[model samples]
Target: MKSYDDKHIKNIVLVGAPKSGKTTLSETMLFEAGIISKRGTIEEKNTVSDYHEIELERGNSVYATLLHTEWKDYKINIIDTPGLEDFIGEVIAAIRVADTAVVLLNAQYGVEVSTEILWEYIDRYRKPTILAVNQLDTELASFTKAVEDARRAFGNNVTLMQYPVNQGPGFNAIIDLLKMTMYRFPKDGGKPEKLPIPEEEREKAEQLHNELVEKAAENDDTLMELYFEKGSLDEDELREGIQKGMLQHQVFPVFCLSARNNMGSGRLMGFIDNVAPAAIDVPAEHTADGKEVAIDPAGPTGIFVFKTLVEPHIGRLSFFKVIAGEVKAGMELTNFANNTTERISQLFIADGKNRNTADRLRAGDIGCTLKLKNTRTNDTLGDKHFPGPIAALEFPSPKVRVAVEPQNKGDDEKLSEVLAEIHLEDPTLLVEFNRELKQVILHGQGELHLLVTKWRLENIYKMPVVFLPARIPYRETIQKPAQASYRHKKQSGGAGQFGEVYLAIEPWYDGMPPYKDHPVRDSEEITLSWGGKLVFNNCIVGGAIDSRFLPAILKGVMEKMQEGPLTGSYVRDIRVSVYDGKMHPVDSNEISFKIAGMMAFRDAFHQAAPQLLEPVYDLEATAPDTMMGDIMSELQSHRSIITGMDAANGNQVIKARIPQAEIDKLFAALRNVTQGKAKIKAEFADYAPVPADLQKKLSENYKETVAV
Candidate 1:
């Protein structure tokens, strides 16, 4: 293999909805470039992109695969990403590093739910994009409708660069508007033969060609002036103008292809090689501290790790893009994240499951290295003398959660270790061990995402796992003030334990004094270990109970707050004052005071109006207008309060606040109600009081569980 400079490199990512033929397109590209001898299909379960066992079993991509090919002297690194919403993290990581994205659309379906969702990220990264309308050979394929849908969804910037000459079963040719030529492919569909446009189709081709020329000229002042004078742009001028327009996002050229049959792919590859932007062409990356790092071969050595894969028998493989200078074998770089040095033993270019060893990776090139001590995904490695850490990639929060436990009961430790390893590969899968709930919760994107995780745990880790309904984190608080007293006396063996305490409890609020009548005197406000605040006022004048014993009493009060008297949930927002107490000199120890404080706090809490509060989440659902009514009705039935609604991108955005308990299986429900056309995002808002009847039921259930 020869080393290419940054100018000869092109980084591209293939993204779209599931069944959009991304993997098939990737296979065709590799075959046309001579990187693979034969193209493979998803049905055969032999495609290079979807190589994982789980992916093969499901016939869908679950992870992003990296592969490279050389076309017309340009090295194109293609990152094939998963289109399912469950694995959106893979798409996000690929788009973050690539200079261009080729968003594929199903010719029959046009813009789909997943396509709309992915378009948002593509716009966020501002990557120069080319839209490829695939499956043009299918019976239901409609090129004009797909183009119109693209225009409507992405605005008028979408201009047709190519269209099938004879679509459907006989789709073996395409008219290239930019080149003003016809690309005729053989029945088997490998290499294309260039020919002049047929006389019958020349009229429409000429019109589209002129439209393409005008769209290109509008992006640049020089091109616009030249077009006005000459009434057209020559071949060279048109290509230059289109490239410039693409980089500025002023023009989004659409192409036609049947990736399964390998028709029109060679021409598309040529367009990418000649027109797509390179890494250096992209805007410079910025560090977390707002420092710009340019892609210069002579600058400091910097490689940003975008993805990590754990290969069997080979350890961790860190896939990175060299942003500054070049990285060679045996070079040592500092991992800025952990402030540790890692020696690069070898560098290799990835091709699906195989790897081609490279002596060195130049700037703007992507490669993988094995066995780094501290480097992980989103970490930056740079020369020690020029240490600049790039900001990490921002992933969406997990939307679905399930309580997971080991089926064998003794595999708890093994389960934790395996989950930690999986988290390293996919950060979107969050594993949380809640001590209060006494459950290990696994949070992910959707049901399919967690299902795949469960399969991995059972098959790869040899540990059977079960997912249970997650417990809600409810809180306990008081609504009114109350007073109580308790005495602790225990006469064991030698010395007696005796202490008496009288305390007043009230609901704490901001700007409220310790008491109504008593003046401020030695009051302490401390944050509870769990949450909320604890205001303890020591009104013990003349040393009724020793000042040293005040902390001991407060300790006991905190202990009771941890496990509320009404329910076992943690308590919050309350104040206690020990105005009077009795103590025996012989038995007035810390234990005696602690016991008395705990008993008095418990009695006062029962007297006060105790209430239960459940966590609420701000919910946002995006769906088609037809399904908005159904979604809103379903939310209302779950005790949700609709806050606002708006229209966006031909869809309705419904915002509401709903209790966490109501959303245990919300993702599945929303998918069912909208026929998988709606998406949702949820985040914790605040705790609100539960309904009186529901609160009583929860209290009873908690008592029963505690008793059992």
Candidate 2:
């Protein structure tokens, strides 16, 4: 292993939809670079990138894998990412640290749902990208149609650099527009022989070549002027122009390849090594506080941990990118997130499952360190004198939730520890312990996401678990005002308990209540643990009830609020006035007054009209115009109120408010209805009253559970 300067390092990530041949492409690239003797197929489960047991069983990539190869004096680091939407965290992390993204498109299907979804992230990061049309040897492959689809989805910036000559089962040659030559591979598919363009195809090739030159010239003012004077650019000038155009996002070159047969990959690798921008060529990153952090090989050392993996027998493996200066073994750096110092014990460059020991990793290069004490994913480790920490990756919020419980009685503690370890590996898997609902909730992307998590827990951690539907946190509130009085009397042998409470309960709103007639002794506003407010006012006249007893009564009232009278849900938004009460000197203790206050509140709550309030979420669903009617109908069936509708990026944006109860498994249902073309985002809006029939059914169910 050799240490490469920043100019000689090229970091790139492969991204696309599932079954789009990303894994095969990476294997082909590795084989062509002589890193591997033979190409491994996904069906055989021997591909370098898909090495995990779960991935082998599923015949797809479940995690991101790092592989590097030396091509033409450049160390090209390739990050192969998962294409399934459930495992999108892997793709995002890879894109955050890579300099360029190579998005593969299946020629048969063209731009797909997953392709559109990944394009959003690529656009967000403003990455320089190259579109590779893969599976060109398949029966249904069509290069022309694929180009048309890319133009429609991505706009006019898509420029063609290569096109298939005879693209079917016998696909062997591709016309390279940049060099105005034909690369013809043999039937067995090894190195391609460069030849002049045939006479029949010369006219079309020349036209496309001129178009490429024009597109390249548009990227720089000097290039444009030189093109106007000379009417064309030389080969060297064209390569420089294309590189500038790619960095500015003015051109997205499209290349054709058949990854399964290992054809056209060498040309793509050559283009990447010669044209793609290096890590130091891209713009500088910024901190969360808007301070620029340059990628300087001479500056203070800084490393950003983008991914963490937990091996079977080994400890944690932290994958990081050197942002500034160099990292070597036995170097100490400050963890900016926790303000803790950690020592780098060993440095290695990853090649799928294999690792090569390296003496040092320079700036703008990716490598891994073993067993850092406190550093985790998204943490920044740098010199203590650095100004601030680097910006963290913004992950998508969880869309689906399920309540998980241990199969055995005493496995709760073990489950907690295992869940913490899982979170450390993948931060998107959220585990929340809801004390009010008495359940441990696991939130993830979708059903498959949670299913994979459950598999890991049972197989890796040896913990059997059951997943159930999560309970909705419904609330209870009063509708009107009512008055009640209760007297608690106990005649024990030694001491007796005697306390009476008279309280007025009313629905509280924004402004202060009217206590004009009575002089208020104590008044305080409290925020309920559930969702609303509780207003307590003490208007006792002439010490009817002692001032010290007021807090005890409030405490009892709060206890009742935790378990509402109707359905045992948390209660909120009510005002209680201890206007008058009676007490005994010896027996008027906290317990007596507490019981008295509890009884009186229950009596008054029954007198007033009680309502059940359920949580509502603001939902935004983006889908094509053809699916708008069906989506709106589906939302209406779930008791959703359509708030607004607008157009966004050629899709219809539907905004609505839907109840939390109705959103269970909604993501899976939407995927089925829209053919995986729709994306939904939801957040907590507010609490609204549940329908009368639903409220009655919920109350009856609660009572039955309590009785059992």
Candidate 3:
């Protein structure tokens, strides 16, 4: 294996919407570089990037695949990410380690909804990006419209680097702006023959070329001065200017491509090798403690594991990037997170399912190894002298949730192991077994995301599972104050048990005034684990209740709070004052007091008008303006409170707050209303009181459950 420094390595992540030809382009790149003898199409199910069974079945990329092509003394590591929004976690992992992003656009549809959402992440990181308008050979492929869409979504920095000479159907040539030449490819599309620009296209080519030069020169003062003096820039100067512009996010160079036919991929690779930023060229990585780790092979040996894949027979494969130094096969590195030393038995570069063994991988290079002990997705393994932990990758919060259970019921333990492995691979899918609800909830990016998880559970793990509606984590609390008393007595036993408790229950709120009618002798405000607070006050007058018996009384009240009186939900935000009680000296034990307190609190809760509060979430949905009215109407019917609306990139962005129970309904309606073009993101806000009718129905349901 040949070792290249950080400067000779380029980590390029292929990202776009579905049918943008990312997988096909990946195959073409490998074939062009002679790594593969021939290209494989999606229909053939033999493409190197889409090697997974699930991907081949779906005929699309599902997970982020890692493939490298050694081209022109530079090793370009291409990470082909899924175009579906449900598998966004895969895209996020790929982008974090990538130095440059090649965002492909299907010229037929221009910019898609999924691609726009992914672009937000790329723009947020300010990564050096290249826009490849692929599939120019397809029918209705308009390069002008795609470029227009790019400028609208990505600002004026969308600079045109090449224009298709014959875009639709017979797209065989592209006019290069920087080279001032034309690349005419043969029918097969491997290598292109350099030719002069046709006279008919000379005017448009020169105009776009001048515009590209101006956009590039805006990034650096030196480039600006040179451009003004010479009225144009040479090839080297233009490349330098574009590199600087990409680093600063001042330019997104657009290239014409028909990745299916392999017309312009060779030139695209050449540009990536020369203009794309390498790890050495990108900004230094920051540690958790705010220290910078420069990309240098001579520094401490450090590798950060950004992804983990667990196969049935292969166990776990840890994919990592060498951040600061090189790691050989026999090297021993310590996991900075857990302080455990790990031995590098073997290092291998990955190409989908294929693994090519290598002696070592240098800084900024990505590779994978098997049989790592106690290493996870985000752990940083390095030499013992390496300073500290690297910054962990941030994943988006889950927006959709569903209850899941194994079909066999006996496979519960195995299902747990499967869910754990799933979470290890995709952090966005959260698995939680709710103790109160008695259900296992899987929270994910969307409905499709959960469906994919279910498919995996049934197929890969062989644990057939069924998905149910996730129960809302409702809370119970009183709306008004009420008083009740209870007496617990048992005469059958020797030393009869007898105790009585009198207490007042009222709603609790922040910074509320204390009760003054009976002095609050002592108050302990407790924060409930389920949210909200419970303030227990000991207000005994004339020794009505002994000081020693207060704990017993509080314990009973807490039991009632755990299984709330109204709807059997966790009670929150209520104050309880023990004003008076009676106890028999001979039989007044903790058990007697506990029973009395619980009965009394339950009795008072019914009189105090308890209300059930369901969890609510803040949601923001984006869709084209043509479908905004239909989406808004559907949302309004689901009790969504439309907070605001705005226009972004010629689309409507709707913001609303909705109860958790109605979330599924809103999205189901959106799919039909918008034809699956709407994108939504939701997060937990705060719990609010359910509607009056809903509270009554829920309370009645709890009563029926208790009776049964």
Candidate 4:
């Protein structure tokens, strides 16, 4: 609701694995900052960040929500993001706008999949990072073990900024290594009271303090010398070194807290203020057009739209990060991607579902603009000549796909239109129409991702929908060579037509000149060349076939190629040589030759060795060593073979090749097999011939379906 200049703002994003207390930590930070009168538990569905109906029902954030709270005269823009693997796009979007990432780890569980994922994302952006070991009051909470886990997960970059003085029910205070003081929680349930460090924990605290000093010294040679000489450093010197170290990604400060109980929130806020980088601290960003620009208040205005939200009643909302100069209401900026100018009708800062109009936005600030034509997420806005576009945020490929249909017949138009709008808001979700299958396919990261999208379509768009399993794209091709002929004769017509065609169909093979010579790159599907060297010698020694009919015959053969001789799917890699044919002087028309050619190809292909080519995918799975055998066996059951395997961070990275059909609804199977410990990624590899046994049955089925 209020705008803060770059100097007075602290952009911190809360990220981690699902159920890692990111939302809870946000609520605690808001309450402790006195932004809210009372804290709302996630179970009650009253938390500020997870306010959406779906989020409340699921008890996990499905999208990123921005909340602002003023603490100690600084504006802290806290971005609460989804921790589930399905909604990684939301986490990436939030990370792009934040200056620092506060990764929350469940003290009991330590690191999980989502936590490891966020670590890589934060590392990619190279932003200052802080580790918040949350839920310290839980039954299995252990600060020491959690600290060790963090170090193990993130390598030696992780350093403790503060350690829990006690654990579980005994968790009453936190030792602030920077200030060398302990903040003791009130036993009667009130604000924590500051006190001198206890004598018993003093020795351990000092040890941690020395460790902090050693890590901080690496940030600057002067600081390192200061520490070596005095065996310690002053608070101001240590704070400066910590900030420098964090911005350079040299030392990651780890802080402990119990977000659900609101313990250590105030200290968390203090650490963010002192440790997080300001707009000036981060390096200047480059526009998509390759121009380096600072967050200059005086330069030409430019903003990168990182997120888009669609409201049922309200218009489209575009969330943008200002990269250069400033933007104000009524100012128009060019959308370089589309090469169109969009007027900044009104600018607002997003606060959950509500947005407050702002007169203008300076660099390094996130704001929303209403109803910008031709503007979408990842598009940059700037002056007409300098329409800067920011690099698009990378998102994981969709792992699950399903065909969807409106439950009610009349909701089709509305469902299609509304889903299009919904997809504009969240780019991670995909909607596509499969003309061949006659289905509207929706793709997402996992099953839950699609489920949430479907739920939103029903509730937000007021449309009921049904989902069906995705069908594998199976193809048909011939295996052996065969010859056949067809004659077309129409005597009833005034211009009595007559044509004949003879063609041979053969198996498409590799290492052969025309077929095998096609560029074989590291991608799915080999490139096919037109008229390479199939040798279609029209050896009609006499005037039996007209020269003009050759094009018609080729066209007919091309059309038939699309609908293979076996399955009704597209055919690939075969050579059909039309060596001979007959034609009448007056009846050798294009239509006659077309029909004759089509029939001739059909006859020849049936005799040829026909086969089915199924789509295969390169599968990569990473899991603990204990589950390596299970993962490998699961792949084997899916008719897969391991290509390679290697050790990665005490886990096994298994690489295999599998059929796409076997991986449909793979998320469910993976969860069942690995107990949710294994994760996988797959990409289309190549279309290979089906196994001998399966090919026989499929070819038989294809013949029956296309019987004349």
Candidate 5:
């Protein structure tokens, strides 16, 4: 394969719902551009984009695939991303560096849940987008309906640039309404033949052509006048206006094609060459210093690492987008986030598993770097004096949880080091150490995401790890006030020890929930002053306890709080006052006061209304109204309460609150009931008191387990 420089770069991300032929389109484009000898098919399991073993076995894309091909003197970097929600992170990473997104829609299905989600992301980024309605030759294909669906989902800005001439079994050609030309292709891949519009389709083509001209004219005053006066517009003027409209997001042009037959692939390429934004045409990106930098082939080098892949044979491969100047092999660039310099080597443009080396990369291009020590996904690389990080795409938090442990006894040390590196590669994969639970928990978007991490552990790091259901982190608190006192005495040593401490525990009734506001912070000490008038006055004029032992008594109270009275869980929010204490002048020391404080806390907590606080999760679920009954019933089974329900895109969104432990397997349940059509997002909410019966059972269960 021949390599190209960045001057002719165009980065485009292919996105859509599952079974939308995104991979087929990539294969057709590669074959037509002479980048490949024969097109690979998804059914044959030889497609370049879905080349991963897991993908081939599943017959669906599980990650994003990078492919580079040359067409019309332009080097196009195409990213094929997974359509399933489980792998939406891959789609997010692709859009981070892309200048444009082409959303593919299955002709029969129109626009589905995944397509709408991808479009939302594109809108969030304000990136230029095009809609490609695929499977035009299928028996259920309907170009008019597909266009209408796009308009309904994305508003009236959706405009058609081309239309298929015929339906299934008779599909043979596509007509460019704007260019007023028809491109016909044979079954096999080859150059398309430009011909006059078919006689039968001429009337429809003219109507579409008139609509296109009017839209283009609306964007250009001169074209509007010319169009009004002459009833038509010149080709150049129409093209320029459409290009401007596309750049400004005023119009989203839709195209139709059969990717398997390679039909309309060349015309699609022609549109990309004419309508897609060049490096210099893209809006200037702002740096961290608030300085605007132009995206030009000759500008200073600024590379944004959008994605990182850990291959068993290749080590770490980072895919980066050239946002500013140029990058060459062996050059050094500073990481803006960490302020560390890294040497670049062996730059290559990848097409799935295959790669072609490039001498240098310029603005608006995507390429790969091998073996960087500190550079990671989302890290920006540029000159040290003006280093800047690219704005990261907003990714949803990992909602699923699993606990992982190294299989080998000694592998624990290596497991942590390897997982840390893995987390660096994909920030979406979170590895957290639950100090209270004493578990290494791994969280990701879904079950497959966690499974892929385990696969990486075994294949890349040569470490076997066992995964188990993660335990929910729970807390203990009190509901009423109680006071207790205890004394400690010992005379075995030369210096006898004697000390006594008094403490009081009370229920926390502050308006705001404690841990919900500060999810991860440790328990903090809160001091209350009651006018500082010896709040714990003994009223004993004859000093019963030595004043010097006061500090030791207070220290003991702190130790008791740390070792919770009920379940060893950290106690929080209750107030403790070391009011009155008696200490022996000769025997009293720190140890004696500490023991006294421990006993006092244990006695006081039982007097207080101690209870277990279980965590709740805020859930938002979207499902069709017909399926709402099923979903609500399912939620009820999980001990969930619906707070609100609303309408969205022909679906009912159920906003509910449920316990975290109750919905541990919600993903599987949701998929089963909705047939993988439901969408759900959840976050940690406030904690509520567990019922008396359940609390008693939990406490006893915990004690039994501890004893074991």
Candidate 6:
């Protein structure tokens, strides 16, 4: 493979909803660029972008794939990403590094739920984008409606660069607005012949062409003056102005395509080569200290790993973009993450599983290197003397959780090791061993995401795994006040343990007075690790209890707080006033005071109207308005409080406060009800009291466990 300079590179990520023909479009682009001799389809499970075993079985792209093709002087690196929301992490990572985002909209569905979800990230990064309305040959395809949907959802900047002359079954021609020429393709659809606009479509084409000329000229005053003087801009002038608009993120040109038939991919690739912005044309990247750094080929060697793939037998492949300078095969670079040196032993420009060995890759180009010791996603590798380690990529929190366990108890260690490797490959999948719940929790985007992990374990790792419902981390707190005293007496012949404690318990709240009922000698406010506060007040006077025993008393109280009296959950937000107590200097050691404090707190807790609290999450569900009833019903069933509702791109944005216990169920339910058209995001709000009935049932279950 030949090396391409930074100016000749264009990195574009394919993004769309499922069935939008992104994989097919990628295959057509590769075939058009002559990188692939023949085109493949998702139905045949043979496309380079969707080459994973899991993807072959599912017949869609599951991972983001990096493939390069040379068009004229440009080396276009295409990252084909999955459209399903379950694999959003892959799409996000690809968009983070892509210079241009080619957003494909299915002509059948226009802008879909999944596309709306992806548009947020693209808009956030402010990438130069080109919207391609694909699958125009399908029966239900409506090109006009698709353009309207694009303009409405994306913005008015969606310029119509091309439109199909005859859509539906006989779609074989497109009118290019910039060139003012008609592209007539053969029945097989490649290398279209240029022709004059037909008389019937001439007026509309001329009006749209004028609009395109003005849109192109609006970005630059020189282009505007040229447009005014000549009444129109030529192809070269239009390209310069459009490229300027794209670099400013002020224009999103729209094009027509039938990727399955390979109708318009050649023209699309031509525009990407001629008009898309390169790395240096975009904004400078901000460092960890918020310093802007330009992409300098002559500056220093820098490569940032953006994605990691672990094959069954091929080991780990680190995919990275050359940020500055050039990296040659066999060169050594220091890992900014761990300060260790890693040799760039084997470099390849990979398309799917296939590799084209490369001698060196320059700045703004993406390629893969195999077998790095301490490199992973978000890590940077550069020259030893160069400052590097770019800011890390931010991933969304998991929306679904499941408790996973091995079928064979002996495979627990192996399962942990396997899961750790999986996490390295994909950071969105979070794994944790909850000591309080005594369960190994696996958090991911949705059910399919977790099911894929299970499939990998069973098929690739050769391990049997079982998934169970994850336990909720509930809390216990009191609703009222009560008082109790305990006496600990232990006589073991040699020494006797005698201690008595009197304490008043009250429910704690923020900004409350410090117990007017008791005079305090000293106070200690403790912040519990389990998400609440604990306040202990010592009110003993006239040496009713030694001050030295207070620490031991607090320790015993903390131990009890760790396992609350009602349901063995963590207790939070309560105050204990130890106003009176008795202790023997010789017999009453720390142990005796500890025992007395534990029993007294427990006894008072039982009488103080203890309540159970469950975590609450602020959830926002976005979907089409047609599915509003089903969404409302699902939330209502989960006892969610619907806070408000808004409209986003013709879809409903429903916000509510729902219990954490119901969030996992809501995720699956929403997907099924909307047929995977709904997108949801949840963040922890505050903890609220559980329903009375649920509290009673939970208490009974805890009692049964204690008895057993």
Among the numbered candidates, top lDDT falls to: 6
Provide the overall lDDT of each model, using Cα atoms, as 2-decimal numbers: 0.89, 0.90, 0.91, 0.80, 0.79, 0.92
lDDT of 5 by residue, 593-670 (tens): 778977887888888888877789999988667788888888988888899999987668999998888765876688
The list of candidate 4 runs beyond 4 A from truth reads 1-3, 188-190, 384-387, 408-415, 513-543, 692-708
Candidate numbers sorted by lDDT from highest down: 6, 3, 2, 1, 4, 5
Candidate scoring better on TM-score of 1 and 5: 1
| Model 2 lowest lDDT segment of ten | 512-521
Clash count, predicted structure 6: 0
The sequence of per-residue lDDT tens digits that candidate 3 reaches over residues 1-708 is 677878899999999998889999999999999889989999999999998778888899888999999999999999999988878888988988899999999999898778898998898778999999999999899999999999888989999899899889988999999998999999988789999999999998889889988988889999999999999998999999999999998889999999889899999999999999998888888788889998888899999998888877888899998998799998999998898989989999888899999999999999999989889888999997787888998888887789998888898888888898899988889999899888999988877788888988888878889999998889999899999999999998688998999999999999999987689999999998999999999999898778999999999999998999878889999999999989887989999999999999999999998888999999999988888889889989999999999998889999999999999768768877876678888888999989999888988998999999
Cand. 4 TM to true fold: 0.93
lDDT of 5: 0.79
**lDDT against true structure, model 3:** 0.91
RMSD of each: 2.1, 2.2, 1.8, 4.0, 4.9, 1.5
TM-score of 5: 0.91
TM-score of each: 0.95, 0.95, 0.96, 0.93, 0.91, 0.97
Candidate 2 residue lDDT tens string, 423-476: 888888999999998899998877788999998999888899999999999999
Best by TM-score: 6
Steric clash pairs (candidate 2): none
Residue by residue across 157-259, what tens digits does model 4's lDDT show? 8888888877887787888888888888876333788789999989988898988888888899999999889988888888888899998988888887878
Per-residue error for 363 in candidate 4, Å, reads 2.1
* Candidate 1 per-residue C-alpha lDDT over 1-708 given as tens digits, one digit per residue, 9 for 90 to 100: 778999999999999988889999999999989999988889899998889889999999999999998999999999999988999898999999998999999998898878888888998888899999999999999999988888878989898999999888888999999889899999988888999999999999999999999999998999999999999999889988888988888788899999989997888889888888888887888887888887777788899999988766788999999988999999999998899999999999998998899999888999999999788899999896454888789888998889999999999998999998889888899999999888999999988999999998888777898989999888888999999999999997899888888898999888885495444468888886666888998877766788888888998998998888877889898988888898888888898999999999999998999988899999999987889889988999889999999998777899999999987567788888986678788999999999999999988998898899
Model 1, residue 492: C-alpha shift (Å): 0.6
Question: Which is the winner by lDDT between candidate 2 and candidate 6?
Answer: 6
Q: Which of candidates 1 and 4 is the stronger one according to lDDT?
A: 1
lDDT (10s digit) by residue, model 6, range 1-708: 777888999999999999898889988999988889999878788888888899999887789999878999899999999999999999999998999999999998999888988999999889999999998998999999998888888888999999999899889999999888899999999999999999999999999988989999999999999999999999999999999999888889999999988898999999999899998688877667777667778878999899999998899999998888899999999988898999999999989889999999988889999999799999989996556678788888999999999999999999999999899999999999999999999999999999999998899888899999999999999999999999999998988998899999999989998798889888999999998999999999999889889888899899999999999999999999999999887898888999899999999999999999999999999998899999999999999999999997888999999999999999999999999999899999999999999999999999999999
Q: Is candidate 3 or candidate 6 better by TM-score?
A: 6
